[model samples]
Target chain A: MKLTKLLATGAVALGLATGAWAQDKTKVGFVYVGPVGDGGWTYEHDKGRQAVEKEFGDKVETVFVESVPEGPDAERVMTQMALDGADLIFTTSFGYMDPTINVAKKFPDVKFEHATGYKTAPNVSVYSARFYEGRAVQGHIAGKMTESNIVGYIGSYPIPEVVRGINSAFIHARKANPDVQFKIVWAYTWFDPAKEADAAKVLIEQGADVILQHTDSTAPQAAAQDAGNVITFGQASDMSEYKPKPRVSSIIDNWAPYYIARTQAVMDGTWESTSTWDGIREGMVEIGEITDAVPADVKEEAVALMNSIANGEYHPFTGPLKKQDGSDWLAEGETADDGTLAGMNFYVEGLEGEIPQ
Target chain B: MDLSAINPVLLVASLMVAATPILLAGIGELVVEKSGVLNLGVEGMMITGAICGFAVTVETGSPALGFVAAAVGGALLSLLFAVLTQVALANQVASGLALTLFGLGLSALMGQGYVGIKPPSTPKLDIPVLSDLPVVGRILFGHDLVLYLGIALVAAVWATLKYTRAGLILRAVGENHDAAHALGYKVIRIRTLAILFGGACAGLGGAYISLVRVPQWTEGMTAGVGWIALALVVFASWKPWRVLLGAYLFGGVTVVQLNLQAAGVAIPVEYLAMSPYLVTILVLVILSADKSRAPASLGRSFHAAH
Candidate 1:
């Protein structure tokens, strides 16, 4: 009798709490692929989340679940967030592409934003920054700085996104220094510092004077610092802590403007499903300050290249290019279309290893 | 392929550094399992130690003092597990898993402010004349004090477990706790001490990662190494020297795969990335084929009754 009375009272309280929560204020949810404290990729995304809060104040409520694995578990978290009255949700990371779509189908009223992905529904919109643009600048710097003529790239996965970065960087690097050779090591993880460090050390030992990484972490930067003369560029975030020596420059991912815009869209009832690929011009992909370690000429060249890419004067994937097998890929004076670049799987000419299927 | 890029001496030296943490954790678990306690909270104890070590080192500017605090922190976290399993007689597996989740959360909470802050660098031990000997010197002599300590602990553990009377008692308690209890042994007390030692060792391994390896405090920075150390203990089949061998083998595979990639070997990157885990499991299966030698009363609880 006592248990029944208590249960009835608890149910009433829970109902009233959720009822009050649903009455007003838009709730935005974020799902991160790593811990916010990673000081790299997830950290930047969390900064964007905070930016939304700062923009909207009490008019909006933001909640986030960090370190969410990219699989069925992500779907469950999204589903729960949607059910809990989230008006808009952002699923960050490429691996969350499918899960975001799957949950968006179930919660059609709830708006969905998936990062670095290409799937969409009536409710799900896909967005990504052209990180390869930043890679082109990094390539130029790496090419000019390499005394050993060998540049190492640490890849997180063999996905199209990563392959594109490698190809873009390699092309620009080889252009700057014709004698430059590329050594690629795939760590197969987004954020394992030890493995990333080991990859950096191996590349350094192999006479690579410059290291490029698509993985998230400052381990490679630290490893380059330890290796004394090796140069590196920060990936996904401006890892400025190791500046003036190992980290000469970096690629910064700026997601605040887009995140704030999307939240405002949801608030104004103007949200719609769309695919947005913003880069330097859109201020989505930013180049961090090139430190004193980089020669003034190289820094100028990198900045000029970045400006040209930003102002539509040049494309990173311009033609007179060949596939890895030496087959003609892009004819002279031709440029890669968005379709090809989006689904890019094969490496450009001169890259040795096959992109693991 | 650019095979000339591979340097044999540097490769061997790095493999030792890579193997030290797991080796330390494995040796600690070896002792705990020997005393009939299967505490699966190695991951939790390790992360707790990582944060504690990192925070203390940042505060004191002494890596050695940080390691001491890390060991103590790890042991304290393990004490919760000890009380639950040894005193309260809760199920070991569930309790251990809970401890891991708790430790991970606690470490994340503690490490909030310490993120991106660099800890004091651990200095490598320079042995006067020996460290200068061309190739062999760097491989053997030029390492931080912890690397040598990890190997020394393995040796001491082997010697103690093989020859000491205390080893016999611990083995007796593990193999048949009821019989050992009848023969006037404190099974719970012995197991508690073993658990604490395991926690401390795992803590030291975690510290090695945060202070020396990655040398930073990021959440989940230990990143499943505790579980690898757990598998390594079993892969070694409860032997100390074999644990060292297994650790170096795993580390060697890891380093070699990266080198192979750097050297531009023709293998697929995916295969090379998975090689360390595949090799470790394969060797474990091959070595354990003859006989399965695990402690008989491994996960059983004990209580003294009137």
Candidate 2:
């Protein structure tokens, strides 16, 4: 009888210990659209996740599911994380907007943070970096550097974010060199290296000396290196391995600061559903070091353009812009409102093609 | 549309590079299906080869040795599938599917440290005057050694399967494994050898993508090429030369669509993007109606005891 009582006491203690442990730790789950090693967008988001871990230590537990396709499938992953007792989750992809919303309704108590989506709920927060500002800088450099007067762009899906980037880059390129022409190819995938490489090479064969890509992956950089005398800018990550040559400069998405702050709020019970769009000024989008492949004067001009955007002294979609069909958009000295930029679907004048709607 | 910007010579040359990977993998799968064993693990095996070849190339700085390592890696993985289906008598379909999953997971694990590191490039075979002979030169002579090897492999496969003794025996076993076994032809042994050849060829195909095409390692870099290769084998009706033709058609359309988009042609981008798949299927489907069918014993597990 005494031995049986002892065993019963041990079982209760073990059960209580697990319950207390679960209550004490805040679990954060991350859903990534690409592998952590994609070396671009997903890789940068994962770095932010790592920063959260470093800040909170054992008080916070982190879990991540990578390469989650953006469809009904993403709903299953988000729901699974909620069922597993996650306190907050970050869905990092533009394609996961609907899935994030659907799962948010089912798990009303779990907090959801999605990247690059506009929808929000009582428990859902949306955040995105203002990447167009970086594109303005890249365009200035691309315009000044292209000896062939032809610049190539590889786009990953014709989303508003991508459309805005093309407009911003084209505007600056035209501003710098009136004779510059833009050649655009939509790759439709965010991270297929072979497809991205093919797009870059095709553009090169058509006489484009300067290449720009909004897709995630360093394939274009490698293609540019092989083509010799061609230049490309790093996208989403530093891609420092190809520095000083094909990769002359870069637009880096730095989410660590925002990730850390959000986690801290959750821990302190101060979290609220909000929309955050931070750019270079707020340190969410950073401009990587400009390598010496570019002339010193051109790098300085690019840096000046970047500073103007950060200081709010300039907006990428500034005055005198027109729609592709020649309809007036922003009049002289007028800037685009956040709502218009958020749902951007039209190409600016001289962008050379339909948005592929 | 600025039609003048599109270069026909460059377009054909790139399509050859784009087609080599699929050609290599398709010809390999054809041999496997011909041996009365169906392995759906081509994707997994190709990805495994991609990493193995990439890692070896990065370490040794020699693309040739890297390709050899890729072949060995692919064959070793296929050996697992052979043992499960041949010795233990597992369901061939289930075993093949499992092998694919295992290969994908294993490759992802092996490729951990190899991402972002560019491998040494495979040198192009510049054949002097022939390489400079305008359109003919660019399309026919200006490709890496492996691209030529892929063509040579298709020729060798065609010659051997159509005229050689080993080819006759292999076909007889695929047609009637029981009869071949009754005649003391060692049916299981022949099937195993075919599976190994398929794996090695698939490995070489995968290395072509990592070492020459994209020339860098990324997870799932082979993407859907292996599946395309598998479909090409069936689409070509298990014929070697047609597989080559199908690969070029698909690759050619792929390159041309991108070129069209770059040239700012007025075609819908989505339709252009899918035209390669459509054109290949339409051509091969029409041709298959005349005199083509799958091997009878394909995907059937054989047992001497039964």
Candidate 3:
């Protein structure tokens, strides 16, 4: 009788232990296009995920899978994570659009967040930053600093996001200095350092004193450092580590506030499907401190422009622009609307080349 | 098209750099096949070279030393295939495929630390007056040393095969191993040396990619370059100069497509991106259709005991 009673207690204790542990934490999952320590795009997103953990302490549990290619593989990973009880999942990449939608359709209970994608289901939401706003600032700096009147742009692909950045930078730079021209080199990839560096070298040889890139690597900055006196900006993260040399300023994507707010919404039971596109005005996009590379007057002008943009007192893209083919694009004092910016597939007049069809 | 926008110099220079990895791997495979060894582990060995090259470059801050490490890594991995096929007398085709699979997985693990770090820059050899000439300067005189070495290797291999007595013996062994064995040439030893040389070249190619082409380490960075290199050996009809021609031709397609996009040609980005691979396939199909050009002992295995 005593042995039977002891056995029943041990079984009961084991069941309670599992139940308690499962109930103690809320599970969150993240899938990335690159390794978490890339010190660039995925690195910044991982930082935000870490912020969520710190804020909630023991209340939340998180898991991540890195270097997950976007396609059927992504669908499998998402489905598996949901089946394993991921309350919320973030699939980060433009290519993850269909996968996120497909997974959300199957798992209605799981919340899905996709970066730079447009597909949406009842349980899914898409989000992207106003990266063009940062480009506007870089354009202003490039316009003033360029003695050769030439700027180089390393483009990854002719996607809307990359096209939008090129146009925005051109719009603002031409506004500051009418003589400024853009020399573009398409590397045809999101991250290929050799190609990107070679493109930069070609541009530098072509007399471009300032360089910009839409690809996700610091190759441009490294190339700029080697070229001496050339200027470059950081993409996706604050790469101030290479500061006081090639990196004059950086466009820092602040995803922490959004991540914290979204997780809290999940906890408070008020989570709803919505698209959030925030910029410097909403503290979602941040500009790193200008280094000693810039002249004091230029720095002051840039800060003034930043304040105006934040306060809604000025617009960088307020227009008087022409297409590369010398066609009228925007009327005087008229800014491009969201629709035009979203589908921007043409190069403006100041850019010497065309955006291929 | 704007010839002015082409920058003939940079185009030629880029082509040379791009061709080196392919050339090294292809020429190595050519030697292996000439000696009646079929090794598909070229891809695996190339990847091993990539990771090993990147890791050493990161540690030592020297791209040259990294290339050396890459060769060593590639050779070591190739030995796995050698022992399996030579000692165990395993099927050569299956052993080669296994080597590729193992190489890919091992490189991914080894490359964890090198995921995003920028590798050390390769040094440029500016050929004084030649580099200053308008069109020729950028193309011929402005390439890194690897480009020149790759060209010289092609010539050296060509001369050895065409003129040297050792070349005659290697050819004799590959053509009729049993007859060569009776005449006192160690067929196994010769074939093994050729296999190791192929591995070293593959490693050099892999290193050239990590140290020059992409200049960073990522999972699957070679991205079928090894396979393309293998295909080129067949496309070249086992000739050294033809291998160079095939490599540059493929490299030209790659460079041209990118140029088209940059110059704002009216092609969809996806199609433009896939064009090079498509053309490569078409070229292979056309070349392979002419079976008369293929080697007699292309995939034959020789066993002394048998």
Identify the candidate with maximal TM-score.
1
TM-score of chain B of 1: 0.97
DockQ-sorted candidate list, best first? 1, 2, 3
Model 2 TM-score? 0.95
Docking quality class, candidate 2: medium
Candidate 3 chain B least-lDDT 10 residues? B1-10
lDDT of each prediction vs. the true structure? Answer: 0.90, 0.90, 0.80
Grade the docking of candidate 3.
incorrect
Of the candidates numbered 1 and 3, which has the greater DockQ value? 1
Off by over 4 Å in 3: A1-25, A35-39, A50-63, A226-229, A267-269, A319-340, A346-353, B1-5, B32-44, B54-62, B80-142, B158-195, B213-224, B257-275, B278-306
What tens digits encode model 1's per-residue C-alpha lDDT throughout B1-306?
878889999999998988988888889999999998888999999999999999999999999999999999999999999999999898899899999999999999999898777788999989899999999899989999989999999999888888998888999989999999999998889899999999999999999988888777788888888999999888878988888888998989999999999898999888888999999888877887878699999988888783
lDDT, candidate 3, B1-306, per-residue tens: 343555556666666776688889998888887777889999999999989998999999998899889989998998888888776677889899999989988998898877656788888878778888887777777777777888888898888877998887777777778888888899878888888888988988988877787666766667678998998887777778878878877776776666654454556656766776677667765765656354455566667775
Candidate 2 ranges beyond 4 A from true positions? A1-23
Global Cα RMSD, each model = 2.6, 4.6, 6.8
DockQ of 1: 0.68
Worst 10 residues of 2 chain B by lDDT: B215-224
Candidate 2 lDDT by residue in tens digits, A1-357: 675699999977875664466578988899998778778898899999999999899989888998788899999999988877789999999999999999999999899999999999999999999999999999999999999999999999889999989999999999999999999999988888888999999999999999999988888988999899999888999888888889999899999898888888888999999999999899888999999989999999999889888998999888988999999999999999999999999999887977788
Q: Model 2, range B104-172, lDDT digits (tens) per residue?
A: 778879999987787888878788899989899888888888899999999999999999999989998
